[model samples]
Target: MIFAMVNVLAPIFAITLIGFVLGRSKIELHAGTLSTTVLLVATPALIFSSLTSYGVTPTMLLEMAAAAILCLSASAVLSMLTIKMFGLSMRSFLPSLMLPNSGNMGLPLVMLAFGDEGLKLGVSYFFFVALVQHSVGFSIASGSYSMSHLLKQPLIYAVAAVILVSTTGIAVPEVVLTTTEILGGMMVPAMLILLGSSLAGLTISDLRPALVVAVSRLVIGVLSALAVIWVLGLEGRVAGVVFLLSTMPTAIITYVFAQRYRPEPGQIASAVVASTLLTFGCLPFLLWFAVKVLEQS
Candidate 1:
C-alpha cells in the first residue's frame, strides 16, 4: 500500500515542484496558457480515454453519480452556511466557498489509492462536480450563474462523448485512442508543473486563509462522507473514494474564477495553496483510516 501510494503521489508532487521552481526562477512560462492547455486539450483526452476503457456498469455509474451529487450538495450547503457565518460579501463568498480541486489533485490521489475502479468513480464524480461547479459553483465563484459558462466546459464535452460511446457499445478506434492517450498522458505532469508554478507565488499572508479553507474542507468533507456512508451503506473501495474525493483541496479553477470575477483573489489563491499542501498529509491518513474501517466491516 505504501509503495502504491508513493508511486502514485511522487510524480504528481515532483512535477508540481518543478513547475514551482521554474516559476520562481522568473521563467517565461505562461501560467494561463499552460492551464488552458491542460483543461482544453490534455484533460479532456484523458477523461475520454479513461471512461471509454474502464467498462463501467450502469449500476456503478448510477451509484457514483448519486454519490457525487450528494457530496457536492452537502458541500454547497456548508459553503453557504460558512459564507453567512463569516458575513462575507457575495463577491468574495462564492470563490472562497464553492469550489474544490477534485481534478488535478483529487483524481490522481483516487487512482493511486483505488486503481482503475477508483478511477471510474473519480471520473463520474468529476463529471458531477464539474456540472455543479459550472452551474452553482460558477454562480458562487462569479457572483452570478451563466448558462453559457456551464456549456463551455471541456469535461462536459468529454463526459457527453463517453456516455454516448458507452451507451452505444461502440469501441473507439485504435488510432484515435492512441492519439488521445498520448495527449492525455501529458495531463498529470503538466498539471503538477502548473501547480508548482502557482505555488511559487505563495507568501506568508496566504497561509491564514489557506488554513481556513483547508480546515473547512477537511471537517465538512469528511463528516459528510461519513454520514453518507452510514446512511447509504457504501462499502469497500466506493466508500474510500467518497472520503478521499470529498477532502480534496480547493481547485485552481476556483482561483481562476476568483481572479476573473471575485473580490478576493488573494484569499482564494491562499486557500487553494493551503488546502493542497494539507492534502499531502491528510490523504494518506484518511486512506488508512477508511481501509481499516472497511476491513472491520
Candidate 2:
C-alpha cells in the first residue's frame, strides 16, 4: 500500500513542484496558450480517446454519470451545511466548496491508482463535474447562469460524439484513436504544471477563515463521497475514482471565478492555497486508506 501510494503520487508532486518553481523563478511561459491547448485540443481528445474505449454500454455510462451527479449533489448539500455552520456567505463559498479539482488533480490520481479502466471511469466522473461546474456551479459563483458559456466547451461535443458512436455501434477509425491518445497524454501533465504555477502565484492574506473553509472542504468532500458511494453501492474502480476526485483540494479556478464575478477573491485565493496545502498533507494517509480499506469496498 505504501509503495502504491508513493508510486501514484510522486510524479504528480514532482511535475506540480516544477511548475511552482518555474512560476516563482519569473520565467515567461505562455500559460494562456498552454491552457487553451489543454482545453480546446487535449481535453476533447482525451474525452474521446479514453471514453470511446471504455468498453461499457451506454446504460453503464449513464449510470456512472448519475453516480457523479449524486456525488456532486452530496458535496453541495454538505457544503451548504458547513457554510451555514461557519457563517460564511453562500455565494462566496458554495461554488468553491462544491466544485472539486476533478480535472487537473483528479485524472492523474485515478489513472495512476487504477490504470486504463480507472482513467475511463474517472473521465466519466470528470465529465459530469465539468458539466455541473459550468452550469449550476457557474450560476452560484457568478449569480447568473449562461448556457452560452457551457455550450462553448469543446468537451461537450467530444463527449456527444463518443456517446453517438458508442450507442450507434459505429466504430471510430484506429488512426483517430491513436492520434487522440497521443494528444490526450499531454492533458494531465500540462494541467499539473499549470495547476502548480497558478497556485504558486496566489497570495493568502488571512489564514483563519481560509483554514476554516479548507477543513470544511476536505471533511465534507470525504464524507460526501463515502455517503454517495455507500448509498449507491458503488465499488471497485468506479467507487475509487469518485472517492479520490471528491476529496481533491478546492479547485484553483474558484479563485478565478471569484475574481471575475464574486467578492472576496483574495479570500478565495487563500482558501485555494490553504486547502491545497492541507489536502496534499493528508493525501498519503488518504491514499493509504483508499488502498487498504476503500479498495475493497
Candidate 3:
C-alpha cells in the first residue's frame, strides 16, 4: 500500500519541486501568461476531451457536479462558523476556506490514483469548482457579482460544448480529438509548476494565524467530504475523487483574489503556502483511507 501510494505521489511532488527550484532561482517566468493560457485553452480542452473520450454520461456529470456543490457549500458554512469564532475577516478568509486547490493538486492525485475514470470525474468536479470560484468566490472577495464576467469565462463555453456533444450524440472528428488531447495534456504539469512557483515566493511572516487557518481548512474539508460521501453513498472511483478533491488545501487563487480585492494579502499568502505544505502530510493517509474504506461507500 505504501509503495503504491509513493508511486502515485512521487512524480506529482517531484514536478512541483522542480517548479519550486525554478521559482527560487533567478529565472523569470511570465506566470500571468502561463495562467491565462491554462485557463483559456489547456484546461477547457482537457475538460472537453476527457469528458467526451471517457463517455461520461450527463447523469454522471450532474452527480459529480452536485457533489462538488455540496462539498463547497459545506466547506463554506464550516469556514463561516470558524471565521466568526476566530474573528477573521470574512472577505479575506472565506474564499480561502471555501476554495481548495482542486486544479493543481487534486486533479493529478485522482488521475494517478484511479486512472482515466478518475480523471473523468476529477475534471468534471474541477469544472464546477472553477465556476464557483469565478462566481460566488469572486463575489465574496469583491463584495459584488458580475454576470457579464461569468458569461465571458471560457469554462462556460467548455461546459456548453461538453453538453452539446454529450447530449447530441454526435461523434467528434479524430483530428479534433487528437488536437484537444495534445493541448489538454499539458494542464497537469503546467498547474503543478505554477503551484510550486507560487509557493516558492511566498513567506509566512506569522505562523500562528496561518497554521490555525490551514489546520482548520483541512479538518473542515475532511469532515465535510466524509459527510457528503456518506450522504450521497458514492463508491469506487467516484467516491475516491470526491474525497480527495474535497480534502485539498487552500487554493492559490485565494491569494490572488485577496491581493486584488481585499486587504491583508499577506495573511492569505501565508495561509495558502502553509495549507498546501500541510496537505502533503495528509496525502498518504488520505490515499490509504480512500482506497481501503471509502471505495466501498
Candidate 4:
C-alpha cells in the first residue's frame, strides 16, 4: 500500500515541483496562455484517449452519471450554506468559494491512484462537474448565468463524443487514436509544470485563508462523499472511486473565475495550492478506509 501510494504520487509531485521551479525562475511563460493551451488542446486529447481506451460500460456510465449529479447537488448546497453562515458577500461568495478544479488536478490524481478504472469514473464525473461549473458554478461566480459559454466548452464536446461513440457504436480511427494517445501523454507533465509554476508565486500571507478553505473542503467533501457512498450501497472499487472524487482539492479553474469575478484571487490561489499539497496526505488514508470498510462488509 505504501509503495502503491508512492508510485502514484511521485510523478505528480515531481511535475508540480518542476512547475514551481519554472514559475519562480522569473521566466516569461504566460501562465494564462499556457493554461488556455492545456484546456484547448492537451485536455481534449487526453479526454478522447481516456474515453476510447477504456470503453464505457452501461453500468459504469449510469453509476458515474448518478454519482456526478449527487456530488454536484451536495456541493451546491454546501456552498450556499457556507456563504450564508459566513456572511460572505455575493462578490466574495460566487467565484471564490464554489467549484473544484476537477480537470487538471482531480483527473490526474484519479488516473494515478486508480489507473484505467479510475480514469473511466473520473471522466464521467468530470463531464458532469464541467457542466455544473459552467451552469451553477458560473452563475455563482459571475452573478449571471450564461448558457452560451456553457454550451461551447471543449469538455462538453468530449462528452458529446463519448455519447456518440457509445450510442452509435462508432470506433475511433487508429491513426486518430494513436495521435491522441501521443499528445495526451504530454498532458500530465505539462499540467504539473503549470501547477508548480503557479505555486512559485505563492506567499505565506496568501496561504492563511486558503488553509482554512482547504480544510473545510477536504473535511466536508470527504464526509459528504462517505455518506453518499454508504447510502447508495456502493462497494469495493466503486466506493473507493467515489471517495477519491469527493476529496479532490479545489479546482484551479476556480482561480480563473475568481480572477474574473471575485476580489480574493490570493485566497483562491492559496486554496488551490494548499489543497493540492494536502491531498497527498489525505487521499491515501481515505482510500484505505474505504477499502477496509467495503471489505468488512
- What is the TM-score of candidate 1? 0.90
Which pairs of residues collide in model 3?
none
Whole-model lDDT, model 1? 0.74
lDDT of each: 0.74, 0.86, 0.91, 0.71
Candidate 2 TM-score over all chains jointly: 0.97
- Candidate 1: clashing pairs of residues: 16-192, 20-196, 94-140, 101-251
Candidate 2 Cα misplacement greater than 4 A, ranges = none
Instruction: Give the per-residue lDDT of model 3 (tens digit) for 192-288.
Output: 9999899999999768779978999899989989899889988777888999999999999989888999878999999998999999888999889
User: 1-297, model 1: which lDDT tens digit per residue?
Assistant: 777666766766777778989999967989889888988899889888877877766676678788877877777678767767766555564444555677777776777667777877887777777677667766866667688877888888887788788888887899988888789878767877887888888653556556767777777777777777776788888888877777777777777777888766888777777777887767667767655565246
Model 4 / residue 94 / CA error / Å:
5.3
In candidate 2, how many Å is residue 117 off? 1.1
* Candidate 1, poorest ten consecutive residues by summed lDDT: 89-98
* Candidates 1 and 2 compared by lDDT, better number: 2
* lDDT winner, 1 or 3: 3
Q: Is candidate 2 or candidate 4 better by lDDT?
A: 2
**Candidates' TM-scores?**
0.90, 0.97, 0.98, 0.89
Lowest summed lDDT across 10 adjacent residues in model 3 is found at 288-297
Mark the regions of model 4 whose C-alpha exceeds 4 Å error after superposition: 94-98, 204-208, 290-297
